[model samples]
Target chain A: DQQVKQNSPSLSVQEGRISILNCDYTNSMFDYFLWYKKYPAEGPTFLISISSIKDKNEDGRFTVFLNKSAKHLSLHIVPSQPGDSAVYFCAAIMTGGSEKLVFGKGTKLTVNP
Target chain B: GAGVSQSPRYKVAKRGQDVALRCDPISGHVSLFWYQQALGQGPEFLTYFQNEAQLDKSGLPSDRFFAERPEGSVSTLKIQRTQQEDSAVYLCASSLGQGGWGLRTEAFFGQGTRLTVV
Candidate 1:
């Protein structure tokens, strides 16, 4: 059973527009959630994270909204640029045992110029 | 190294062969983790080490998979009797904090080692 899921395999957005990527989870034990961006032939880099205590976190043009009761989260990028094109992965960690991160299948986002 | 480093960016092995994947974490990082990513799938946690002690190995797939962090700096993941299904990209990541669940330490990753079992 997948604890975290990114149902959309891919998404496309126009530059200067807003791009929204969604994720869902089944496990309620997850307390910390993170988003990662990965480019071709490179490792994933941390983008942003949110704790369960908060409902939203924002950094620059990027914002992450969490709905704990719905078991869902979404990443919003305003004024999306071509450089934002990449695979986005959503991961969650429980509050114990080294906090092993559980990842989703990932969503490929393409920002058209 | 300035960031996490993984050796043998690519590896090809035949069935029944044994392969070892190496990971060099950032200098002074206290937490190390190993994850396996299959095609079109996200990375799955395999194991974790806090300094020299392995705090978690629950994610390891099977008995054939083994990992060690002898000196608390470098880690190696070994697979005995490779199978075709074992093909995947093995990723290594590290954090600067000790073993704490509530701590929000960011983990940095390496380019990973792609393993192909023929």
Candidate 2:
């Protein structure tokens, strides 16, 4: 069973607009959520993360919102640039229980110029 | 190296052959993890190490897979009698602390080695 799910396989947004990608999880034990951005032929890089204790965390143009009660989270990129186009993966981990991370299938975001 | 490094960026092994993949973590990082990623899928955990001791390996697919980090800074994942299903990208990541809590310190990943078993 997949503990993490990114139902949307792909999303498209125009440059200078806001792009939102959503993810859901079934495991309640997950306390930390992270977003990683990956380009073709490279390893995934950490973008932003949110601890379950917080509802939102932002870094420059990237912001991650966590809704623990709903077991859902979303990543928002404001003024999306063409360079932001890539695959975004949502990952979850139990803070002190397990060292491994469970990742979603990923959502390919295309920012059109 | 300034970042995590993996060798043999690409490898093609015949079925029943054995292959070994290597990883070099950051100079002072204390945690190392290995994950396998199939096409169109996210990375799955394979094993984890704290210093030179392996703490978790429940994610390894089978007995053919084995990993060791004798020096704590370098690790090797070896697969024996490879099968077609063994084909996937192997990624190695390292963090500056220990255990699950250490991951909060930001795990840096290597480029990953793509293995194709024919």
Best by lDDT: 2
What lDDT would each prediction earn against the true structure?
0.92, 0.93
* CA deviation > 4 Å runs, candidate 2: B100-104
* Candidate 1 docking classification: medium
lDDT of 2 by residue, B15-47 (tens): 999999999999999999999999989899999
Clashing pairs in 2: none
Q: B33-80 in candidate 1: lDDT tens per residue?
A: 999999999999999999999988999999999999999999999999
> What DockQ does each candidate score versus the true complex, computed on alpha carbons?
0.68, 0.67
| Clash list (residue pairs), candidate 1 | none
| Candidate 1 positional error at B79, Å | 0.6
Docking quality category of candidate 2 according to DockQ thresholds: medium
